[model samples]
Target: MTNPDDPRSLELVETELPQLRDGEVLVKVQAAGVNRGDLLQARGYYPPPPGESEIIGLECAGVIEDPGTTGRRKGEAVGCLMAGGGYAEYVAVPEGQLMPIPEGYSPTETAAIVEVACTVWSNLGMLADVRPGQTVLIHGGAGGIGTFAIQLCRELGATVAVTAGSAEKLETCRELGADILINYREQDFSEELKGKCDVILDIMGAKYLQQNLRALNEDGQLIIIGLQGGVKAEINLGALLPRRLTVRGTTLRARSLEGKAEIVRSAVENVWPMLADGRISHHIHATFPLAEAAAAHELLDSGAVTGKIVLEV
Candidate 1:
């Protein structure tokens, strides 16, 4: 399966799964979650963490083949984020990153749900400390993490506003509980949203920096999770300081195993109940076979998807 002719564009030739380490479990992957970073990694822009597998998928849902005395049981339905490599038919993941698939959810569905929940929970729920009735302006509201953020923030009693490229995507955001929709292509978001936001969750850091600052209310928090538009930015510290705005940035991929595991555990405890009760649901825009990973990358790169995309192995 590792040869050039193997037909899986995401996997390099001669790639092989290594023996499971002491705290690792082998997963028979049924589906893998696709993220924009996966495309970057395929193009050699993002490198896997040292000592982790070189395979390119960050998250997957599947059945456990062996638990390796890691407290996981064989045949347990589980989802996990790999340091690398989830596009393959099987992946060995550290036990710490593993979470059981919510009851009755398909592996394909669970694959799409896990990554978004973890990302939003860590950023909005844990870091930002979003409070009830506060307004959250989320950039890319129709994308994977944005969709989840809308639902999670609403569940926590925050008013959600989203910026998307189209009215159609905005409608989807509305269904997900977004109270305000700004079509960025047609309007200046900062000008439209001026003085309306209590918190801003941004992915296009530099592209939206100045305006994002302008949109915030006093004591607002700006949490940046991605630099989709480019990293460099110039900010007036006076604007930030006088407004009592807090600016923060983070990346989930570089986190320690323990930190990631704690996030997974917290999500299971606090957020999974919402899923079980149907208060939060996943929105899957499309699914592709694992072998057609390049096409999945193309779809995400085009920015045409309204929600999460998944790969069935």
Candidate 2:
């Protein structure tokens, strides 16, 4: 739990095991994934949904310790897409949010894959309906979501373009199948991709709004998943009208239980096969012991990490 006064002060302390509700199971967590949303929660900017756990983690891989009325066998290994509470030793997971671990993936790898896979698949595959021959632009291409999105887009037969902060990061994106790489620090991605992107996956929020609009082709869609940049921005309504452009913002954690369950099911059905066959690979930049979660948060916040971070229990 974050301290109200000093939000960055993370400490490991004993807490009661979460009680399982109907249709939920108790999972003994093996590893948990660290995400930018955790950082925001620690900073008091993001809060878990009502009636959810106060713990920071959003995804984990674990064994079912108590299969409370879910009919799942105890000791089953599962990857969990969570609303919250994944950072602890034990978490109560809704049965619908549980997924089988991909073949050839360990707990840490599974932890790294769950949240990003569901997010990317839900937005690109389900909502945007990304198709072959369409161009997709991803911001922060070297990060966890960006890297996963790049490979997934390639698998969907889309032309992938990415923007990263450095040439080294761009190279990483290239290796992951990004067709066009723009170093955002050196090049204006919007200018380079003007009216070329069929879909733009944006994390920068307001800072990139106008540029993202400029970069979109007619009838393009912009999916804003993160608000790393400021959230308030003025948009020209006329511009959107003439271009038939659409902008939608979404958050997985805030969705209804049924909504999350649908996403989890879709991700498992579609993305798990890719993971199992190595078409889309999970990337873990680093791992820290669960107790060193503060340090892990610092590392991710430093902007040096190229992929996901996992906290091992």
Candidate 3:
């Protein structure tokens, strides 16, 4: 999607296959995962990181086009974390970012898994170290990241709390084993869980900043991955100091190749087992053909999608 204001600007243009740099593998993409990062890039608010593709996609599933040294063999079915270009029929990714598809998963299903798994694992498990018995409060619990997080945190032995805008969505969260369900539209979420959270996976930014701090217990960590609410907000050091709180912000697309590779490594090692063993499954809210990318974005904007929207290429 090129134009920020109009989806019609997303024209499908023909292009030559991308050149392979050192440590890169060519992928014949069968599906791609749509993320909020793609939406922001469509709006021109988040452009590609330096030297990355202008095409708007963050993750994909495909077969390896050639033998590569990063542990993937030719013709292997793999899912890749991409900086961009997953929307195309083919994309070139750094070898370290490609991982074998989870056992028995289709290309489309596996496409939706990598982005959320890598994201939640990196922030909650690796960064915050949200261990067993801790309390995790996740906002936007019906989202791709939120759904994956609730299940992962629960499996890790944490009590999961989630805030969704509707009772129906809250029920879905409950089905996912979220212990505490808050209907944000009808309840004061911070008051409901004040001083009770060990970790908060937040998507709402400035709007929830203060309340997120209030929701934290001593030594709590708040990881901000999205800024849907707003960007800038005033934080009281007085409160943060006494609580010994930590606030960290991160994104997957803007990282260096090595950084993303490490995150993918951790995700494959830890999260892939759960998926392959049937302890966890990918949730796909909707699917669309590659040509109907705008409609997929429209579905995403509808605010009713329960999980991910995958584009079949």
Model 1 global lDDT (CA atoms, 0 to 1): 0.87
**Candidate order by TM-score, highest to lowest?**
2, 3, 1
Better candidate by TM-score, 2 or 3: 2
lDDT (10s digit) by residue, model 1, range 126-145: 88888998999999999999
lDDT of each: 0.87, 0.94, 0.91
Task: For candidate 2, report its TM-score.
Answer: 0.98
Q: Find the number of clashing residue pairs for candidate 2.
A: 0
lDDT of 2 by residue, 106-141 (tens): 999999999999999999999999999999999999
lDDT winner? 2
**Candidate 3 clashing pairs, residues 3+ apart or interchain:** none
Task: Rank all candidate structures by their lDDT, best first, as comma-separated numbers.
Answer: 2, 3, 1
Predicted candidate 3 versus true structure: per-residue lDDT over 7-89, tens digit per residue: 43576789999878789989999999999888888888888888988888999999989655555678988899988999999
Please give the lDDT score at residue 161 for candidate 2: 99
Model 3 backbone overlap count:
0
